[model samples]
Target: MAEASYPEDLLYHPEHDWTKIADGVATFGITWYAQDALGEVVFFDPPEVGSSVTAGQSYAEVESVKAVSDVFAPLSGEIVEVNTALGDTPEAINDDPYGAGWMVKVSLSEESEQESLLDRAAYVASLT
Candidate 1:
């Protein structure tokens, strides 16, 4: 089956995060389908801004009524910013996972890792 939902502008990870490379930084967020599957988000434990994060490593956490889930880094980088809004209004994750609900922005320490991540179509294909 073909993918019903995949943003052409974003690169994706098998872990369900999406990255939008802008400027020299990459803005990232959880995909909509992932937010839905996680249920309602109530809290986020994101990495501190300026911290170095390694790809495929646990760098953040998302908490819902049911459980807390770890968010993995899709690429190695130093976090330049985190969505402070999610701290107060975690439900924004469900309401606008791709926009205002974005989790972090990082200055990529290595550009080569981007090639290893999936494009939108591949991400959707993996979901199947």
Candidate 2:
């Protein structure tokens, strides 16, 4: 599993998801806390590229040696890209939860919704 970290550059969801937004698009992934909690990742089931994702709803699932966990969308959007690499190298999620482990890229449908997400400080605090 990845070393514990809550990157200050990304926004967080209470469910342990993170978002990296830029120019109306965003990359979504489970946070460091998530992969670590799930143990070694072995599978990633992603939504299709054109599928719509709703904030606070599960858009995909990640399976670890311990259990399968739903991956929530932190904002409403249409999935534009999926990390296909994870299909063959699921261990990347455990080795690099924030980098090669990212799950999808989406064209945002509601950019303003990002304001509701937690900042790193608040997210870390919530964990305690």
Candidate 3:
């Protein structure tokens, strides 16, 4: 896989969640690849603030014209904030998968878990 494939700075989950840590909190969202696969997102159901989420488990869901996809937690943690903007305009996800389309912030319970996820190179390779 080329360096230009997936965002190298983030961690990727097999289910398509990507997490970027900043100021000790991990911000998460679906990858561009995921949004493309889901197709024309129409709705997003984010977990409530302060909800506890386990690693490798669904914390939210996205409904698209094609199907519904679970948004998994990249790691075990408590959700601190959600991108409320997505609820009003879910298509933002397909238009900007890595920016304003971000889903939530999780106060990471175990920082070491970040090391276990796939990197950009590995994630792209996994696609094949």
Candidate 4:
């Protein structure tokens, strides 16, 4: 399992998703808390490129040793790229949820929605 971390540069959602915005694209992934609860990831089927994803919606599915969980979108956007490597080694989601475990890169559709996302401090507070 990876060490617990909530990067300061990323914005977090109450559902345990995170996004790092750069330009108009944002990279999305589940957080450490999320993967920890789900246990060792065994499968991940990502959304197709160019698919539209709405903020606060499930865009993909991840199967873990413990259970399968929906991977949520933290921002509304069109998927531009997906981490294809996860299909071969899903444990990356458990080992590095914030890095190689990142699920997708999206061309964000609604910038204003970002205002509602929490910072690392606030997200950690919400956990307790």
Please provide, for model 1 over 67-115, each residue's C-alpha lDDT reduced to its tens digit, 9 standing for 90 to 100: 9898888888999999998989889888887788899999999988999
Q: Total backbone clashes of model 3?
A: 0
What is the lDDT for 40 in model 4? 86
In model 4, pairs of residues that clash are none
> Which whole-number lDDT from 0 to 100 does residue 105 have in model 3?
93
Score candidate 2 by lDDT. 0.93
Q: What is the lDDT of residue 4 in candidate 1?
A: 34
TM-score, cand. 1 vs. native: 0.93
Clashing pairs in 2: none
Candidate 2 Cα deviation (angstroms), residue 9: 0.5
Each candidate structure's TM-score, on Cα atoms with residue i matched to residue i, is 0.93, 0.97, 0.93, 0.97
TM-score of 2: 0.97
lDDT, candidates in the order shown: 0.86, 0.93, 0.87, 0.94
> lDDT tens digits, residues 35-91, model 4?
999998999999999999999999999998768899889999899999999999889
Off by over 4 Å in 2: none
Q: Looking at model 1, which ten-residue stretch has the lowest summed lDDT?
A: 1-10
Worst 10 residues of 2 by lDDT: 1-10
Clashes of 2: 0
Number of the candidate with higher lDDT, 2 or 3: 2
